[model samples]
Target: MKKSILAIAVIVTLAFTSCTDDNNPSTPKSTFELKIDDLKGDITDGTVTLDPSQTYTLTGALIVKSGATLTIPAGTTIKTSTTALNTSLYIGVERGATININGEANNPVVMTSGQAAPKESDWGGLVICGDAKVNTGDNGTSEVGGLSFGGNNNADSSGKINFLRIEYTGAKFSSDKEFNGVSFFGVGSGTEVSNIYAFESGDDGIEFFGGAVNASNLVIVNAYDDSLDFADGYQGTITNVYISGVSKAGIEGSNNQGNDIATPMTDAKLINVSIVKGADAKFTAGEQAINFKEGGGKQTYTNLFVSGIDTFAKLDTGSGATARIDAGDFKVNGKNFVSTSNLTTDYVSTETGAGNGATLPTWATKISKNN
Candidate 1:
């Protein structure tokens, strides 16, 4: 009864709230009386399912608090405000909350900016926090929205995420702090993610801040920052990742930001990963395909291929990080991306190579921007 009441209350609020914003005439009040922009605040109970037929314009934050679920069905399109530096508009699932995005490969859920000509940093992206182990703390506060996450539940499930495409995300807060196409903070193994495509992100395409969520079939294109990043004691198995046109390291595998010897450690595995750097790709020193730094922890790479990048891997020689390397805890099985790719080595195997080099992988053809 409480769940039904809560769901009905949300629908009522959306139907009644007058969205006439005198300051910004472009407010969603002009379109429909059931202003989708007014759908903010905490969903403390019940499951709120998004309608695939009706369009959604997110003007503010939509938070799914604990014990709540937000469902987005197949072909659901959600557009956000295009105002520059607007980081407040996003979909965040707090600890104990669930987000079930039911999207098919051909008819996937799409989220982008509502501007006339959308570009990067148009709005924020999906941020999911869970009660998983993190080296940061018991409950670490996230970079965006300052939401609390992390706990002792390694099997905690936030929900399912698959066949979702996020474009032009990564709103900046500071030089070092910014949003990504998807930020998984302390997410656990019970929550599965697959077929996530991130395009033209202003920051990292996808970043895992201390989680044990095993994901696969991830594709990133034209990311302004690192294509993939994992840190803060993240222990997950990421497979079948295809990355290209990245500005920084294709994979920034770090343990922690400031503290090198944080508890737990960012120990993860990569299987059948491909990072292809374009000819025009530019990167700083030590920013290559795989960069192990900040006290990098244990990692096992299998069938990890790199092409068009001169350097394959670089390790931070910092005292803390060097010690970890010297102790045989971290090693880079990197080899040049050349004709001898299929030699069947421990690392740098191009057998599958995800897809055609420097292009979208075959598994991501159904939901790709190029298509």
Candidate 2:
């Protein structure tokens, strides 16, 4: 008779499992344990470096406290649990707090939602907080200093994150607010974020609270919400972004509902960005490719290619919302915006206010890659 199939309950403290070539039944299973206290001094208030050879799983919240830096080496896979029973990894840097996470292109660091195949809901997202400033409107959330951090000051870089891939993130918060694949809250201008990719995020791929941190080489796919949402006066430039949303048919497979705000802001200077709209059929009238609310900062576009938009670009809710069209672009605020460069628009809305019909700047004609 075949040996009885038994369900063994083995408790591994480190919350990770590895494969080996040994076949001895008598050999004890290798186990790794890392308590919060074990990483207390190393990560809480000091520099913590994760070993490239070791696979570490977070059992509770990983807090990168104020005045500390946590560095994660490349080719590291950081996994989290799904159920609420285990605390999620929270990297909230308080006032004057700092974190430096640097990864490479070929060997990028991955922060995922859960270890399992990723069910309906998995885990929380990455939050980078800095000592920058924000303007959260009259609701009084703006007065808080640490509310919006990341900025564009290269000299005083506060938080640094690069070449990071975040997958299956954007946890829900009371149905109204949800976690972003990457959340930059009050991040200062000195914060450096680049070469980041977000896949299958339940919320916004990347949300900026306030600051001037320049980001480039961003890729968002199958995100439930907007690709990039900037609020509270973000004054940095974003380049080379490729955002593609899931089609309407795939909406049923989505983990979260639809996003109230989907389109990117009209403030930051975005060049060479491609936004793929909803593939599903649940789009409301307000869903647009680029929605510039009233009161938003001045914005301009160049070498932009748009497909699948109810409206290409429009100013809706904010004040001072203006999007200057260039020759190298397409529709904006009901005008046929175009660029003299080789750039072209495959589709232009016949709606009167579909495009603003403006000329693109000369600098936009150059297609040189950014540093």
Candidate 3:
């Protein structure tokens, strides 16, 4: 009877221990890696709305195909992968695709690099291509993506972008093909772009490649290249632009590479612009505020204010560009055009008795002025 009782007690103790062990395991549970759908491939033929609650990662080139629309709500933050030097993570809207960025002033849509230490050219930037007019030919190939753009339609609509900010963009693809912060490839006037800002772009802040899109309330800060670059017969009108701390010219204009005398020239008109050089800028001795390379189009500059720069305007050695300026094709109302040879290292102000009676934009109260 004693042996039986001892065996029963041992069994009971073992059972209780087993139950306790089964209830609470000693080894911790393994955590599965959180996976998300990577937005790196083509978005073909559908309307995809990005949820503001969830974060999306861009690994490679995200192409919005023709006849598709990518709708991004307000306060949507897109993070890019930082695995390599040239990750080429970008959002490209094709010729017929549409991108509706409905961001408010308080909650602006931000597309930035995912690198822990973000810098310029960390990844590619935003690209929008449309069927607008261009001088490169009928649907010419874009320099950045080799995409086709340009058509007979001057009012083509790719989409609308408002209250959007792009940071640390302008990844270089090749020796000659470098991306910009925002590249408008044949975008038309029907596209509404306003309240846009580009910060620390490795290349140009905003580049228009043969488009008729009109932009307003644009701001560019610390762009390594030109602040605003218009080339390949861009005929857009810009109003109330602010550029600060640019490495290259504030505005660079060119008609076409092959033929500077190309039709549908880059005839952009600037109404109110302010360009201020940064304190840490290393501008060369002969750099111009505005550089008109080759045979640039008949652009007009009005109500311009520039400071902290040595030179004013540099017109390249082209007879076509000079003749156009002389014939009032390239008109200047509040500022005088300074060629490369006659560039002065003196600060010129439009508000302080310089050229015609032009004043700063009423909305540009935040910008610092020497006048």
Task: Give candidate 1's whole-model lDDT.
Answer: 0.79
The digit string of per-residue lDDT tens for model 1 on 1-371 reads 99999999998886556464456443111111235655556677777877888778877777888887888998998898655346887889999999999889888899888889888787888899999999989789989978899999989999999899999898888888888999999999999899999988888999999989999999887678888999999998998899877688888888887888888988888887878776663444137787776877766666677776666666677776777766666543443222223222334444456756455677888778754
- lDDT digits (tens) for residues 1-371 of candidate 2: 13332223232422233333245323222122334222222244555666656655554556665656666777776776444432244345554566666777566777675556773236556777655544442122211122334333323456677778777776675465567677776566677887777777776777766555777777666666566677655556777666666322111101001221222222466656655564566433234556544344445444555556544544333223223232222233333443313222344222211122122222222211120
RMSD value for candidate 1: 9.7
For every model shown, the clashing-pair count is 0, 44, 0
lDDT value, residue 341 of candidate 1: 36
Worst 10 contiguous positions by lDDT, candidate 3: 27-36
Candidate 3 clashing pairs, residues 3+ apart or interchain? none
- Provide the lDDT at 151 for model 1: 97
lDDT of candidate 3 at residue 206, scale 0 to 100: 93
**In what order do the candidates fall by TM-score, top score first?**
1, 3, 2
| Reference-based lDDT, residue 309, model 3 | 72
Q: List the residue pairs that clash in candidate 1.
A: none
